[model samples]
Structure formats: C-alpha cells, structure tokens
Target: RVMYTITKWIEHKLGLKVNATKTHITRPNKLKYLGFGFYYDTKDKKYCARPHASSIQRFKRKLKQLTIRKNTMALNERIRQLNQVIRGWINYYSICNMKTHMMNIDKHLRTRLRVIIWKQWKVPSKR
Candidate 1:
C-alpha cells in the first residue's frame, strides 16, 4: 500500500531504515506515542489523549522510590523533594485531560506520604 511504498522510498532513496517492530498501521485510537495513549471518545465523537498505563506505572515506581522510609530524610525535606518531582510531572502531562486518573494518583500519593509519616513517628501514641 501507500505506507509500504513510502517506507521503501525512505529506505532505498533516503538511506534511512524503519524499525518494523515499533511501527503501527492501525487507527490513532490504538496507537500510543510519547507516553500518551489516543482513543476515540464516543460521547464527544472525537479523539482524546491520556497517559498510557505503562507511563503511569513508571511514575508510580519513581514516586515509591522517593517515598521509601529508609531514606531517613526530614519530613519537610521529603515533602519538598516530592513536590518538586510531582510538579514537573504534572506540568509535562498537563495537556492530557486525565483528571480522574490524576485524582487517583494524588490519593495514592497521600496514602504513601501518610505511611512514611507513621513510620517516622514509630508509635500509635505519637501518631
């Protein structure tokens, strides 16, 4: 088809190679690019974008590393560090309308922070 011809032209004429393993010839809704997933919104009858599940998982992994209790950092210092990272991540993905997903992430982050604080307190009486 046209795509095959274009790939051949690029390879032969331009001396560029295409990685077939990463290529997708499907609808935009089925393709993921730059940590974002595209999907067609039935209600709006338009295309929409959201962070892919893998991207969210990666973010959570980083957050978990930052929140680990063994770091021994002061509570204020830990919050400051987490704030910087979360701010940058939010800014980068702000274009995607993922309010619900963000809410869930925020809730999970709060839970992690609470657990870290409890561990720092070391006792129910202190907590």
Candidate 2:
C-alpha cells in the first residue's frame, strides 16, 4: 500500500527503525493532520517531501505569549477600577470643604445685618 511505503520511508529518514509494537497505523483525522513527508514554500506555493519543524515550535511559542498578554490585561483593568474610586473620594472631600466655608460666610453676613437694623431702630441687641 502507498501509505505503508510512505510511513516506512518516514521512519527510515528519521533514523527510527519500525517496531511493530511501537507503531500503530491510524486513519488521518484530516488530510492536513497526516504527518507525512511534505515541504511548504510561501514564495512559489510549493509543497515538497519534507515539512519544517520550526513551524510547530513557533506556533507553540505564540500561544504562550497570548496567554501572558491576556492575564496582564485583566490585572490592568482591576488597577483602573481602584484608581477611579480613589479619585471619587478626593473630589467629594474638596466639595465638602467648599460648602463649609460658604456656610460660615452666610452666618457672619446675617449677624451684621441684625446689628445694623437694631441700631437704626433703637432696639436692644438680642445677644
């Protein structure tokens, strides 16, 4: 069978002698999943007898980097929420101080008005 011959060829190229106990003949999950001899070329659209091991390693490394990036993004979002709460508290304190100062001025103005009216009408000061 062509498949058997190809498998034998692959084992020979890899310097791995075929052992019946170790080898298992299985159907391809998909045409691409079959690990046979194949060479791929990006420039000329060619697929030859040998495949590149570098492609497999590169894919694994890229997946690792993506997982790290996702964790960092989640941490940054949590820090952003904490900073927003701190800023809200700061703004609330500033407004409260301003309101207290305004109330003190309002009380002083009312006391001065009462004093002036009492002097004009010859009425005794209440306090």
Candidate 3:
C-alpha cells in the first residue's frame, strides 16, 4: 500500500514516473544509503548509521593499490600516500559509529606496511 501510494504520488504530484524494476520495500539496514548503513542502537536507545561494508572494501582496495609489494617508490612516499588516503577516508567516516572496524583496519594497514618494509630490506639478516 505504501509503495503504491508513493508511486502514484510520484507519477501525479511530482510528474515523475517510478521505475518499478528499481524499487523495492526493505529495511534500511539492508540497503546502503550514500555509503552508509542504518541500524537501531540498543544502548543509545535510537537509530544510527555507519560506513557500509562496500565502502570499507573500496577503502581496502585503494590501500592495496598504494601498498603493492612491487611498487618501487620509496617507503616514505608510500607512507605519505597512505596517510593521505587514511586521513581523507577517516574524515569522511568520522560521523559514523565504527570504532572497532576502524581499529581492525588500522591493524591490517600496519601489517601491510611492515610487509612492504620487510620486502624492501631483501636480506633476512638485514630484515
């Protein structure tokens, strides 16, 4: 009923045709909205939103590109690029509730950096 009403309103009041194939009823938690996922907060007694999983995966992919093992750029340059990516991503996602997820990402990023540095050293003794 709600969807039908909305569709009619769009067609009549807004003079816009609703694309039936693109529309569906779903709980907000099941959909990504502007890279955010909405969920009810039990402790806060309200609702909240967080950076969606696909956004996090995109961030990881970007970091992977920056930290590829064979990229011969100096480690410092790589770190600088990483810093820019992390800072910009965090700044945009700061409003979301994702402390634990961020911490895990930080740990993984540090491990990747370590691997890059280790690869640069080349010799077991030097590493």
Candidate 4:
C-alpha cells in the first residue's frame, strides 16, 4: 500500500514515472549503489558504504589480466599499467571504507606478481 502510494505520488507530483519492476523496498545494507554497499562500522557506530564483494572481484580480475605470465609485456610497462589502473580505482572509491578488502587484494596481487617474476626469469636455479 505504501509503495503504491509513494509511486503514485512521485508520478503525480514529481511529474515522473516510477517503474514498479525496478523499485524495491529494502534495507540500506542490502542495496548496492555504484559498486558500493552499506556496512556498519563499529568504530564509528554508524553505517558506511564500502565497495561490494563483486566490485572487489572485478578489480582482482583486472589485476589478474595485467599480471598474466604469458602477456610478454616488459616488466616496467606492466607495472606502469597496473599503477595507472590502481590509482584511478583508488581515487574513485577513496570515500568508501575498504581497508580489509585492500589487504586481501594486496596479498593476491603479490602472489600474482611473484608468479609473473618467476615466469620472466625463465629458469629457476635449485638451491
């Protein structure tokens, strides 16, 4: 009932159409806006938005692509490209709370870089 009334009010007063299919009444934490979702920050005692898991996964995918061993790109060039992507992404999502996510991505990225370096070295010496 409330949803219908609100939708009607928007259509009538706001002079706009509300698509029923797209409208969903849900908790803030359940909704994701621009790759970010609300999370409760215990330290601040309030809700804060953070990059969603899907968003982080997408970022990791990019890192994986850049760090792929068979790419044959020079190490310096690959590092530069990786830095460019990381900088832009960080700046855009800087406002969101994502310390833990960053840490996890760091670990995964380090492992990928190690694999890349190993491949670049071409051969390993038995110690």
TM-scores for every candidate against the unseen true structure = 0.81, 0.21, 0.83, 0.87
Q: Cα lDDT for residue 19, model 3?
A: 91
* Number of clashing pairs per prediction, in order: 0, 3, 0, 0
Error of 4 at 118 (Å): 1.9
Output the worst ten-in-a-row residue range by lDDT, candidate 2: 28-37
Which runs in model 4 stand beyond 4 Å of their true positions?
Answer: 123-127
- Residue-wise C-alpha lDDT for candidate 3, range 48-118, written one tens digit per residue: 98999999999999999998998999988998998999899989988899898888988998999999888
Q: Flag clash pairs in model 3.
A: none
Give one digit per residue, the lDDT tens place, for model 1 in 1-127: 8778878988999999888777647787777799988878899999998888888899889889999978889999989988998898888888887898889989998998999988888877875
Q: How many backbone clashes does candidate 1 have?
A: 0
Model 2 residue 81 CA deviation (Å) reads 48
Model 4 alpha-carbon miss at residue 63, Å: 1.0
Q: Write the per-residue lDDT of candidate 4 for residues 24-76, one digit (tens) a residue.
A: 78887898889888977789889898988888889989998999888999889
Between candidates 2 and 3, the one scoring higher on TM-score is 3
lDDT values of the candidates?
0.86, 0.44, 0.89, 0.88
Which model is ahead, 2 or 4, in terms of lDDT?
Answer: 4
Higher-scoring candidate on lDDT, 1 or 3: 3
Best by TM-score: 4
